[model samples]
Target: MTLSLTAQDKNTLRTAAYGAVSLIAAADATGSPHKIATHGSIALASATGPVGHVLAEKSKIAGLDGKTVAELADHVLPALTAAMNLLREQDPAQAETFRSTVGIALDAGVGARKGEPGPALTEMRRKISTALDAA
Candidate 1:
């Protein structure tokens, strides 16, 4: 099936994908936040398929400049769900691709830390996965 995403839909997907990496970076305030973000973003860039295409577009994604973690989550978590919902409705396969792409990006981002993730980082990862599954 052909998936027809509007500009807003594409923006939502971009926001959700990029916002997740930002969330991980934010959650690692005490650690190497820049490393985490770079690794996660690189993984996101490596994604394939429709999800990858949407992420690759360098258009105006929304709500990524939040000053606080909580403020960022307010826009991102819902965007994660919304992106998933839109994909699932139009193409379940793409939805799975989207979910997996985000999950892989999260893993790559979190793996930038050499040792076990701290409690806050662990919880933020869980929340990201939960939001992806919420759709």
Candidate 2:
């Protein structure tokens, strides 16, 4: 049987995934808010450019091999999150832009997953939101 998800369900999943992943990403990162802010900003700048495209390409390549969306999400989410975390730690302003970019990417990924953001993108969004809140 095939199951379908509504748009609200997809967005809710994305939000939850992002919140959980951000907590994990931030686990080892602790310091004054300023330091955290600096780090997050840098991380954002570094990730803002190509990470999203890379993940989308990866997803497309994986799909060609008949990989499940779940498989693709599992593989891509951590790399995306880690890259963004690094950017967030280095530059907060850029981090904000990156977060917004992730949101857009997540919107796209949701369609790929049949209205749900893939696990990786969802998780990445969580981390992005957390870093933004921190800044």
Candidate 3:
């Protein structure tokens, strides 16, 4: 919830977030970050808080109730990217902080939703945390 990330990790998350968006946007002819930027913007709006609130709010609005893991990720990722991009243009520093915070939240969300790479990411985080704690 309040993880302290290194600058590099922050950048990594930002890149991943944006990359996920690009992937989804390119996959669909009509989907763009602008179309769903609102959802992600909310998440980025809160840099010092857990991003679960924003993501959950968007999920509810998107009718994620009965959707498959892949379906939810497909929808949420793009929206988040669009929002993050918009937030960056609005406030780069704040958006960067929020991007890293949301990265953790997004990873957890994917795992909870049984997304395609959710388990892998969850496991990787666990391993990384363990290793870091041991250091």
lDDT of each: 0.90, 0.38, 0.40
Name the 10 consecutive residues with the lowest summed lDDT in model 2.
Answer: 57-66
Off by over 4 Å in 1: none
Tens-place lDDT per residue, model 2, 45-128, is 334343332222211122112144344334445434544454456554444555565555333333322233345444645554
Off by over 4 Å in 3: 1-60, 106-119, 122-135
Query: Once superposed on the true structure, which residue ranges of model 2 sit more than 4 Å away at CA?
Result: 1-66, 108-135
Please, what is the TM-score per model? 0.96, 0.34, 0.37
Looking at model 3, how many pairs of residues clash? 0
Best by lDDT: 1
**Considering summed lDDT, which 10 consecutive residues are worst modelled in model 3?**
57-66
Q: Cα lDDT for residue 62, model 2?
A: 25
Q: Kindly report which residue pairs in candidate 3 clash with one another.
A: none
Clashing pairs in 1: none
* lDDT tens digits by residue: candidate 3, 105-127: 43433333222543444453443
Could you tell me the lDDT of residue 31 within candidate 2?
A: 20
